[model samples]
Target: MRAISTSGSGLVDVDVPEPQLRPHDLLVQVEAVSVNPVDVKIAASAGDERRILGFDAAGTVVRAGPEVTGFTVGDEVYYSGDVTRQGADAELHAVDARIAGHKPGNLSMAEAAAVPLTTITAWESLFTHFGADAGTTGTLLVVGAPGGVGSMLVQLAKQLTSLRVIGTASRPETRERVLALGGDATVDHRSLAASVKDVAPDGVDFLFSPFSEGNIETYAEIVKPFGHVVAIDDHHVDVFPLKSKSIAWHWELMFTHAIYQTPDMASQGRLLDETARLLDEGRLRTTLGTEIADFSAAGLRRAHELVADGKAVGKVVVTR
Candidate 1:
């Protein structure tokens, strides 16, 4: 099997043995894979032990484990594979079927690959961590609109809830994309606090920041009393500033469910299934911002470079 691997120095093409299917795993013939910040981060942190450098993938099942009842051979699936296991940079990957979702019927393999990781992050952040309620009317400011997770968050908030969605994007294209994707309005991230205040004088009811590094205090200031803030990036923010507002802080990491093998690990699959239905119904759309033609080591490295540079507008996918 051919795969992209992270050596101590950098990415390289390598030949590796095919992974054996576990009792609950699916041996997927990978069709496409998407790059994420985690892939870049992991690449930088790679040790002497080589590691496959992908997470998001869309593929067709060629083999299914004995205990896998939900899907069969030939099922088209998409998932963010467990970080503890080999990833989907290879032509074949063995993924636990419990965490894989059926690929969106309305999308191509590359488009579906662009969704899983980002969708999972946005879904869990809004519904599980920040507690967005469909019946409730509120205001939400997505700190990095039109990015992979931000794109999904904006759409989900618009489609599933009554919240007035405000998105922040530095570039005009990204701002416009946010509005087109369902943001009630777009705000310049340069002056996020002022821009958010202009939208909601009382402050936003919730703040979701996919890249909240130095703007923690700004988010704290712009959020309403007892409001919630959720972030996916690592940032050193003093919680004391939030003390006066009685705000809640939540950090969302999409890999935690698979990393720990939690009892609700299968919930990721359920989330994907629901997202697939939404996609087929035209309620959600793919976030494929860029596509790499090659699925080789060079292609993977280029995708990682774009993500690591932090200017990518949406998910970057490379097809096999």
Candidate 2:
């Protein structure tokens, strides 16, 4: 099987053996894959071992494990595979069926590939951590609203909840992109506190921070008393300031369920199925901003470079 992998010299194209399928796995012929910040981070720490380096993928199932019930051969699916295992960057890959979902009927393979990672992250952050639902009503602020997860987060919040969505973007184009994704309003992140206050005077009920390093103070000021703050970054933050207002801080990582083989791991598959239905119904849309027509090592490297630069407006996908 032909695949791209991370070597000490950097991303390289290699021919590796087909992945061995587990009892609950689905052998998929990968058609498209998306690049995320995690991919860049892993590649940076690459060792002499050649490790496959992709997470989000869309493809067709060629074989299903005997225990699998949700899908079978020939079904198109999309998923963010478990990080602990070899990834989906190959001509053929194996993924646990419990964590994969049927691809949205209306989406192309490339578009579907762009969704899983960001959708899972945003969904888990907003619903699992913040406890938001269709009945939930309040002001929710997204700090990095034009990036991949932020774009999906803004859309999911607007589509599934009664909350008022406020997105923060520093550039004119990015602000416009956020508004188009269903944000009620957009504020410049350069002056986060002031800009947010200008639109949400009473302070927001929830804060979604994709980059939470130096913005803790601004978050402390912008979030209301008893509000919730959900972050996905790895940077250390001092939560002491939020103590005065009794603000609850949470960290959401979409891979936790898969990594631990949690009892509710199947919930991610169901979540993706629901998201696919919404997409097919036109209630939501794909965030694929850039598509690399090539699916080889060179093209994958270019996709990684774009995401690592931190300026991409939405998801970057590499397709066959």
User: Which candidate number has the best lDDT?
Assistant: 2
Give the range of the ten consecutive residues with the poorest summed lDDT in model 1. 210-219
Report lDDT (CA) for all predictions.
0.90, 0.93
| TM accuracy, model 1 | 0.97
* Model 2 residue 161 distance off true place after TM-score fit, in angstroms: 0.6
Residue runs of model 2 more than 4 Å from their true location after superposition: none
Error of 1 at 251 (Å): 1.3
The residue pairs that clash in candidate 1, if any, are none
lDDT of 2 by residue, 1-320 (tens): 99999988888999999998898999999999999999999989878878998999999999988899889799999999999999988899999999999999999999999999999999998899999999999999998889888999999999999999999888889988998889999998889999989999999999999888889888889999999999999898888889999999999999999899999999999999999999999988899989998989999999999999988877899999
Q: Candidate 2: which pairs clash?
A: none
